[model samples]
Target: MPKKLKLILINSSILLIGIILIELCFGGWFSSSNQLSNLGIIKDAKFEFDVRNLYATKKQSITYTRDKFGLRGISTYNQPEKIKILTVGGSTTDQRYLDDSQTWQEILEKTYRDNGKEMYISNAGVDGQSTYGHLKSTEIWFPKIEKLQPEIILFYIGINDFYRVNSDAKYDDIQQMESGGFVSQIKDKSVLYNAYRKLKGIQKATKFEVGHRKINFSRTPYTQEEIVNEKLLEIYDKKNLTAFKSRVKKLIVYAKSVNATPIFITQPTLTYRIRNGVVYGTEATKYLEEKYAYNGVGYYKLLSKLNDAITEVAGKKYVINLSNEEDWNIMDFYDYYHNTPIGAKKIGEKIYQNLTELGFVK
Candidate 1:
């Protein structure tokens, strides 16, 4: 063979190998096994569902329907005369696992209507939100609520606030926002973003299952209830407590300025009990300790401080202590922090009852 021809052939072979290696690494070829295993799908089986089509489609109407974001019903304008209620909170208020009909907001709306009182309720809950997020949302969406002229604004928050307040997570305030880090920058790259955008459905489902697997593997022995009373208590201090209080106060003043009665509900968490002469921690506590050896007592203390602050801001009339009552069991919680449909219904009923007493509802 000619020396130049031989060298060309060798270079081509090396180039082919390099291309194959690149395809295997960042091209997601090597990620298939892990994705399939997480999905519990058969190896080499072609996926039938178009996950992109499923998730990417925009919802048209809100009435009597669920949105891609898992929110129930629609926002209606110029409804017949009835008491209007607006719910604002995080995932618990969003009711991700529950259908539109099963959410507490829906339950409360139905109850009010059943009792011969006309009412309209709008759910302004978003998942993975914090107190600051709620405040921001209110600032943005208050005009929409104003159009409806809701009589009451019910806010269910604290868990996410507690998490963010104690953790090293950076928040983006209007005054000072942090720029994305290196990994975030790469993920935001146009080429990579476009590629993932093309395959977003499969990517999202794969990512979801992977996340669930990771969380399951990282489970701790303690339940959420145990962490609430124990681990959450240990982290309580004056500084964070004061900050939390100031936020609550700001929220109260904001709510009042809108001429909408502000009702704060202290949502519930999973609880533990002494069984067989042994004490068991809640799942959240167990998961936290097993994965990060996190101090549950600290979190509990923080919650205590938050509750205290809420009470101070709301006074006796506005703050609703849902967690304090035995009728509202801690076991009703779906996970470490969120409530099941049944739990949400219970909360909704309590809120309805309170509103009736306060003349917010007839």
Candidate 2:
């Protein structure tokens, strides 16, 4: 090789190795904006949403309008003859991509009307909210919603809690986790670093395939670096689980005090993929799977633990498990938890069915 070319190759090799080491040591570090917390505020915002499919690769656009309450549906607060229902959750429930008529909350309203009943269901979902945010909403937004005298309050939670576990100090005190300094930022912007990560990811996928896993989609392969420590999971569960239980209790108690029945909904994600009629993969079938895997404590596991806490505290009769529905497909999801219109309608119908079966509604 020419002397200059040899030197260039050596430097590139060192850089690649260095970035991989950094990624391993500081796995969950990501660049996030403070503006991501547009929770229960920011009235009358209009959003133009667009996305292109990865496979079919077609561009799609949808316009969304938020009412004065920063929710996705009609902005009215009063209806005399209609049963008032309030839906609370994160982005999945917020659903900023769909039109007003496409939301599951709106679908539920129409479903009730078809059954000869009227419902004024309000969507109170906000982006990036967790149980902590939901609890805070009770003070910030719920009072406003309470004016409608909501006969039922629905809580959909878990995905954000699972994600915040990585960066939020409240979950595990892993303050060192967000150690993306100057070099890290550089790596994020560098084309070379991204290429290296992709190559490494492909290698991991190949290994999974060789091991008969037969699944790959834009996921980072699991290594010890990606696994959230078992001890951390235990500690996180201990602290957050208690807080989750207390928050659910508060929501339920407050709902009952107003003669409103409280229903807790478990958040679900597309965590698995099937190919050729065989089960192929696991948690976070979309983005970086390693983060959701959290070492060995999978995202679904954390969510399940939180859901279990809800069911135990709220009782089985008032809880609905939508996390592992068999009929949901990848095309129904735009991301981990946020859904396309189809998924929203599915959840809406399921909740409607449950409400009737439990006699919470006619």
Off by over 4 Å in 2: 1-40, 51-60, 75-83, 144-146, 164-228, 273-297
The numbered model that scores best in lDDT is 2
TM-score of 1: 0.59
* Predictions in order: lDDT: 0.54, 0.61
Q: Locate the minimum summed-lDDT window of 10 residues in model 1.
A: 208-217
Give a tens-digit lDDT track for model 1, residues 117-167: 777786667655567656645543344322445577788878766644344
True-vs-predicted CA distance for residue 272, candidate 2, Å: 3.4
Question: Candidate 2, residues 225-333: lDDT per residue as tens digits?
Answer: 2334465577557666766677678778778887788898887665543335433335323223343324222544566788888899999999988775666676566
